[model samples]
Target: MPLILFNKPFQVLCQFSPQEGRESLADYLAIPNIYPAGRLDADSEGLMLLTDDGKLQHKIAHPDHKEAKTYLVQVDGVVDAAALARLQAPLDLGDFVTKPCKAVQIAEPAWLWPRNPPIRARADKPTSWIAITLEEGKNRQVRRMTAAVGLPTLRLMRSSIGAFSLATHPLMPGEFVEVEAEALRVGG
Candidate 1:
């Protein structure tokens, strides 16, 4: 079995199968028989784990395991204590209620690479950075959470999953590395 860590860039589709005009995993990764353990939408960027093991993938992606996934987000507003507090609470988000999660305002990470097409810059509109850790992965949950708190997400990055962190394993966008598969217990 092979385990891979890939730094997926913005605008690249999460799937390996080719899509019209958009770049997909195949454009970056060549190793066969491997699939992403979890998915980050094309708009989001950062660390992703891929493996050939089905059980390992389920453990990583399934909400049942509650493996922590942290996101470093850039929101459109100047985040305040109130906004952070709201994010940490189990506020309703229409279709479903989110689980309580950790949300804190943070300084922009020095390790961050500029997006291919940088986020919009406005002299009067200041942006804020936040680090949020959630056990359940919902579609556009981080973005929606920030928006509900009045801080629309300008950029979102999945920096870590469980013990693996992009901060420790820095790879430029579109780069990937193969690693040991023993990191997960799938034999049970």
Candidate 2:
């Protein structure tokens, strides 16, 4: 089976099922029988994988496989080394302690498309970007992590998972490309 790499837009629901007035995967993809292997929250935007292959979907989305997921996070602060260090070191998130992960301050990516409605802008406050990679992507982990360090997340975008990446396969919102399942570092 083939894999669909979709760049989901902000506010789009992650599932195909209808949800009141909001748009869902069904609106963007016409491919039948394929379902999202993983998901992004309705408020976040980034790369999402959809496939009909059950085992492949499990490897990619299940936490036990330990596939790395990297996020380009825009936080509500002038990000500092202290925050980066805190992100790298695992601070307990109440429910779980994250395994140590790579975190670094980064310039806002030039390749990124501007969000449609856009995040709030305030003259009194500033924002910064950081790249954080973690193997486990539980519910709102990145946002909760940033908030734990006093740097609330303003925008979140997943740039890569395992071997597939946006750097190699740049996609605008609502676009998708099919790739050979074997080409993925995971499996068919």
Candidate 3:
């Protein structure tokens, strides 16, 4: 089985399946016999994993593995400390209590590539940056977590998944790379 690391772009579905009137894995990934290990939402962007190995996919996608994932989130509000603190604490999502996670404020930088369709800008209001890390990724967890605490995620980008990081390789929108399968092994 071979492993591939990709920095997915905005509006791209995480699968090869056809998305009506929308972009999907087919638009970006050309490698044969590879499938996404997990997913990043179509509206969200950043590090994605692909592999031909079923076991590897399960190891990365299954919550039991508790593999850490990190994201750089831009929120609509100022995202005060109180909100940031709540992100680090457990969240009650009705079905279950989310595990504690990590979050911190980050200064804005000009290095990130501009999202193809940029988030709407509010003249009076402003955007803020937050770095969030989670061991278990629930559906729209980061977005939901932020929304629960009064800040809605305006934009989201997964910077890292387990050992692989986008900062190191620097994937522009719609670009990806194939890494040695062993490089993505959790405990190799």
Task: Give the per-residue lDDT of model 2 (tens digit) for 48-127.
Answer: 98999878888888887787989999999898889889899978999999788999999999999999899999999999
lDDT of 1: 0.90
Mind sharing the TM-score for model 1?
0.96
Candidate 3: C-alpha RMSD to true structure equals 1.5
Candidate 1 vs candidate 3: the lDDT winner is 1
Give the poorly placed runs of model 2, Cα more than 4 Å off. Answer: none
Instruction: List all candidate RMSDs to the true structure.
Output: 1.4, 1.2, 1.5
- lDDT tens digits, residue span 1-188, model 1: 66798999999989999988999999998888789999999999998999988888877788877778899999998999999899999979999889999999999999899998999999999999999999998899999999998999999999988777887788999998877766543344
lDDT of 1 at 155: 96
Query: What is the per-residue lDDT of model 3 for residues 152-181, given as tens digits with 9 covering 90 to 100?
Result: 999999998877888787788778887776
Ten contiguous residues minimizing lDDT sum, candidate 1 = 179-188
Query: Cα deviation in Å at residue 116, candidate 1?
Result: 0.8
Off by over 4 Å in 3: 185-188
Candidate 2's TM-score reads 0.96
**Residue 30 displacement in candidate 1 (angstroms):** 0.4
Candidate 3 lDDT at 154 equals: 91
TM-score of each: 0.96, 0.96, 0.94
